[model samples]
Target chain A: MEWRAAVRVTLKPGVLDPQGKAVQGALHAQGFRTVSEVRVGKYIQLALTAESRREAEEAVERMCRALLANPVLEQFAIRVWPAEQGEEETP
Target chain B: MEWRAAVRVTLKPGVLDPQGKAVQGALHAQGFRTVSEVRVGKYIQLALTAESRREAEEAVERMCRALLANPVLEQFAIRVWPAEQGEEETP
Candidate 1:
């Protein structure tokens, strides 16, 4: 089966996120007064073949641990679904 | 009311993503043969106060257009929900 996964890689809390802070400052300058906080991270989308949903999950987990995310500075979360469902290809 | 929004900012299709390519090359070097392709983008989490869900949606959309994403090279998608759901705070 073909599977698609969306992985969100975020800085572990207490880690200084200068990029996020810069973005927050930009928003505030633009008059987004209601926005209290902004944290930025990486979003990765993968398309691959898998035997089943469980297999896909395991593959994504391995990918996250090995390459997709930095375990020391970042943590990742994965969402997996059938590729044919058509959600992965969107911009 | 408080609302949380998650924004995904991705390169428009056909845009060259050198960072994604680097990550993909690293993954292939790691022997993850099943992984066919990888695309990387920005993920942003926002915590803010809003009068209602509709208001929060509008605010997030405006933020996306004005600062959260680069409209020329990127597109953004926003997912909004009540702040108390507690799903937004995970690592």
Candidate 2:
């Protein structure tokens, strides 16, 4: 079966995030005064073939640990679902 | 009311994504051969004050238009909800 996984990698608590601070400043300058803070991170989408949903989740978790996220400074969350028909699959 | 917004900004179809391609190659090299493709994008979280949910949605949409996304090459999706208690709020 074909599966789609969405991985969100975010900075752990107390980690300094200069990019997020910069974005907050920009928003405030643009008159978005109510915006108190901003945090920036990565969203990764993966397409792969797996035998079942359980198998897919396991693979995605392994991938996240191995390459998608830094265990010390970042945390990752994963969501997986069966791929839908008509979704683009690049060759 | 306090609100939190999650913004996902992704490349539109057919926009060249070299980063995605590189990650895909790296995954294959690591021997997880079932991986077919990958797409990388930005995930941004915002903590803000709004009068109501409707107001928060409108503000987030405007933010997307003004800076969060490049409409020519990317598309953005926004999810907003009330801030949960105990969530980190940087002073």
Instruction: For model 1 chain B, give the 10-residue run with minimal summed lDDT.
Output: B82-91
lDDT of 1 by residue, B1-91 (tens): 9898889899988999888888888888998888887889999988999999999989999999998889999998888889889656432
Pairs of colliding residues, candidate 1: none
Query: lDDT by residue for model 2 over A11-87, one digit each (tens)?
Result: 99889899999999999999999999899999888999999999999999999999989999998888777898544
Cα displacement (Å) at residue B31, model 1: 0.4
TM-scores, each model vs. reference: 0.92, 0.92
Estimate how well candidate 1 is docked, as a DockQ score: 0.60
| RMSD in Å for all candidates | 2.2, 4.4
Identify the runs in model 1 with alpha carbons over 4 angstroms from their true place: A88-91, B89-91
The TM-scores, chain A only, for the candidates as listed are: 0.91, 0.90
Candidate 2: list runs displaced more than 4 Å.
Answer: A85-91, B85-91
- The TM-score measured for candidate 2 stands at 0.92
The lDDT of each candidate is 0.87, 0.86
